[model samples]
Target: MLELKTPQEIAAMRTTGAFIAELLDDLQARAAVGVNLLDLEYRARALIEDRGAVSCYWDYAPSFGRGPFRNVICLSVNDAVLHGLPHDYTLRDGDLLSMDIAVSIDGWVADSARSLIVGTPRPQDQRLIEATERALEAAIAAALPGGRLGDISAAIGAVADEYGYPVNTDFGGHGLGRTMHEDPHVSNRGRAGRGLVLRPGLTLALEPWFAQGTSKIVYDPDGWTLRSADGSRTAHSEHTIAVTEGAPQVLTRSLTGAGLP
Candidate 1:
């Protein structure tokens, strides 16, 4: 349907994004070496409850997912990129952790994801994380009014190509509003001039994920977690943005301007 937000609706969405940004930051600060993954998940739930926000992942049922998701956030570890169901695993030093979360506030929804190292970071892992972050920034820059949706995808692809990382377009970004997913699916790679035309008030979640090795992905038997097919490290970065008359507005960044410099 390619839904576009009204000015008032856009403002509401920004409010939701602010809460999400703060929540992600808090969760990251709390996650560390020797911390239990389930503990982080619980913290997310508590914050969401306190703020009266609704988790987009809870009770979420899709064709590919096993059943209704029962978690408030996804905690993906090394070699795991997306849809990671938090378990009782304890974090170790140098472990790569990716956190993805989506929430609805006052009927508006925002989604974002980030990857980081638990304690001491590996140089290669740091590079991989930077690659996804750069790709995310490039995609955000390409999301301008009147620009084709492909422009955003192409920007992400170009960054990935430059970084020598293979991209998997199977599970990329998408539109979101009252619900978490919407029309005009956004892939990680595409022709710059193709796809839907961008317009003011168009909101999207732009995500770019890459694997150090093959572009293929493998699913866990739990039917919720997805990891790199070759067991290579992976990274992902994302933000919810809005297309305006001028530069795109990144709604999912923290108040400290934590996104691109």
Candidate 2:
């Protein structure tokens, strides 16, 4: 069932979203060359503990996942894209990394993801990250009242298409509120005026992920990490947004307006 958050609930979500934004910003800064992926998870766990928040990924056991995901954060490096399981690998210079996180604060949940280059960035890697960022912004802009879910999906697809990237519809955005995932699955590609009707109080996590070479993906033996079939680098960007009477409220934006990129 589709659940619409009340104004009060949205306020609560804003708090959680802000915390996630700040956390991501801090994590991104600490994700330098030579940093271990497991270390990133530990840092995220400590932050969650300090804030008295709960990690949505810690016990997450979706059907597609291996079992309960024991990590506090996802660390997708280079060819790895979504649902990345943190392992004992050290980041290297020029490595393209993507992090996805979700946390619950005071019963409200917020989810977001970002992709960045560890040190010296390659031109193609930079372009992939930028494309996903722009796609995320476009989707958020389309999350206004009176719009349809497809509007957001179409907006995301348009940006990826413009960059000549193929859209992977296997896993996309989803309704979000008290839980980490909910109804109204938002695809990365769709017609502009179709799907569920948008309204006030509707909150969603809009994520756009794409690969440089092909749309096909291969699952890791760990049963959590997802990688590009062609060994091409990929990027993903996401933000939690709420539909309002006017412009959509981007809850996952940092205090300084820093966001996915």
Candidate 3:
């Protein structure tokens, strides 16, 4: 069911959102070459503990997930896109890394993800990451009051299409609140005037993940990490947003802060 958050609930959710954003910023700085994905998970757990927030991913057993997600955060590298289980793998030079995190504070939850290139980035690799960020920005911008869900989806799709990248329709964004996943599955592509109507106090995570070549993806042998079927590089960016009377408010925003590049 789509639960409209009360003003008090939204305020508490903002705290969780800030933590999500701050952790992503910290992870972005720490995801250097030679860092183990497990190390990142450890740091995330500590940070959550410090803030007294509960990780929404850890011990999370969902219908689509394999048993319980054993880590505090998701670490996707290179071809790996979503639901990446952190392991003993060490990040190498020019490796593309995606960190997805979700946490609950005062019973409200917020989720977000970001993709970055470790060490030096190649030209094409940089472009892929940039496209994902642009798509995310477009989607967030479209999440305004009176706007339709399709508007947000179309905005994200337009950016991906402009970059000549195919859309990955299998997994997209969705409503988030008391629980991690909620109502209104938000896809990366859709008609601009259809689907759910945007309203004040409705919070959603708008994510845009794209592969450099094709949209087709396959699950890793681990049954979690999603990777491009063609083994091409991928990028993903997301933000938890609240539809407001003013412009949409970005809850899970990163330190890169203002406008997209």
Better of 2 and 3 by TM-score: 2
lDDT of 3 by residue, 36-77 (tens): 998999889988998889999888887676678888898888
What's the residue-level lDDT of 145 in candidate 2? Answer: 84
Question: Model 1, range 1-261, lDDT digits (tens) per residue?
Answer: 878999889889998898889888888888888999999999999989999999999999998889899999999999999999999999999999999999999999999999999999999999999999999999999999888999999999999999899889899999999899998799999999998999998999998999999899999998989999999999889999999999999898776645211
TM-score of each: 0.97, 0.97, 0.95
> In model 3, how large is the Cα lDDT of residue 239?
87
Between 1 and 3, whose TM-score is larger? 1
Compared with the true structure, all predictions reach lDDT values of 0.92, 0.93, 0.88
Clashing residue pairs in all predictions, respectively, total 0, 0, 0
Question: Per-residue alpha-carbon lDDT of model 2 for 110-144, expressed as tens digits?
Answer: 99999999999999999999999999999998888
Q: Give Cα distance to truth, residue 56, candidate 2, Å.
A: 0.5
lDDT of 3: 0.88
The all-Cα superposition gives candidate 2 an RMSD in Å to the true structure of: 2.3
